[model samples]
Target: MELDSEIKDRSRESPSPEVGIDGRDRSASTTRPTLILYSHGRTPPLNPPPDLKYDLRSIPNPPKNARDAHDGRSKRLREHLLGELKFVQKLDEVESEILEAMEAKIVETAEKLENDQDRRDDGEESRENGEEEGYESLEDEYDPTEAVLRVGCNCALGHHRSVAFVEELARRKWPRNWSVQLIHRDIDRRRGNDKKVRGKSLRWGGA
Candidate 1:
């Protein structure tokens, strides 16, 4: 029954050397190749880290005060344009009314003048019809043909003959019915002849 003190002391101080089932030291054998376990049939689960999370509401929007100001400005501009349109329409109506009144006044004045002339013509016709027989009309006593004269001169005399002829006719009181018109030489040349001085002269002398 006596225990070995040395063996008891070694067991209490450290673990025993590992042994294979065959009674050989396990550490003295070669190491086994490392085995990597992979989950080939399933995809990796997606788990974004906490630091990657974002808050969209943190971004700033346009100021509410500025938006309200822009809306008010647009409304005022629209109202101003509408007011101007109304004013222009009223001005156009006033102008049209004025023009219409002026045209009417002009037409009324013209009609009145025409009526006055017609009344005067009627009165003169009636007076003429009431006259007695053997009374001559004033127009019938006046002779338009007596106021004109006709004279001719040879072409060789040039315009001088026409001027002299007019002077002589005037001295004889023939100018009262006559007027001189120069017949140009070029005009007669085109007609295969030379120009001759010709005029109309009227005289009160016996024929």
Candidate 2:
């Protein structure tokens, strides 16, 4: 009887078996992974920590002299306009080029979403192959933390750059479940009784 009791006690002390979808024992981690969407100078009010933070300025081909340190597919409006400073502000060529580039970039980014071979299973320490380029370990690469990812930016007028990117990212296929919420720092900063708003807000529907 005493031997049976000792065996029972040891069983209780031993770690519980946890098998992941890949049939390997899961790590001792039970944290929910997070994907943050934020901009510079516009942090969320609660100041929550995020596992991954992608600034709107870091994406390739960003508007010149706009990004401070780091990134994304922010509309290069200033660039489009500045290049046409010599011509009238209503230049059709500039508008067409910007529109075309923006559309192409959106499609390109979308296509690159699920192009990884093992993004799903390789998220844990039980990696089957070598580590990916941007990640340190399978744990760091696929850490699941139960936390809200705060995203903010210096979009003074709103509905131009950061807002657009957030909207676009929300539509992408993430490796994990991500509930994205947008909080335009200056959603109404540009609106007033003066009747001067941030001009036309472009609704990038399918474009």
* Candidate 2: worst-modelled 10 consecutive residues by lDDT: 198-207
Clash pairs detected, candidate 1: 147-177, 148-177, 149-200, 149-201, 149-202, 150-200, 150-201, 151-199
In model 2, state the lDDT of residue 27. 39
Off by over 4 Å in 1: 1-87, 131-207
* Stretches of model 2 off by over 4 angstroms after superposition: 1-28, 39-145, 191-207
RMSD of 2: 20.9
Model 2 residue 187 CA deviation in Å: 1.3
Tens-digit lDDT string for candidate 1 (1-207): 011222222222111352433454433222211111110101111122111111112212224553334321133422332254433343344334433432333334334444545665766776799843433334355432221111222222222222222222222211111222222221112223344322322222221
> Number of clashes in model 1?
8
Candidate 2 accuracy as lDDT: 0.36
Candidate 2 lDDT by residue in tens digits, 80-150: 32353332232333334333433333333333332332555455434445555454433456423333334
Q: lDDT of all predictions, in order shown?
A: 0.27, 0.36
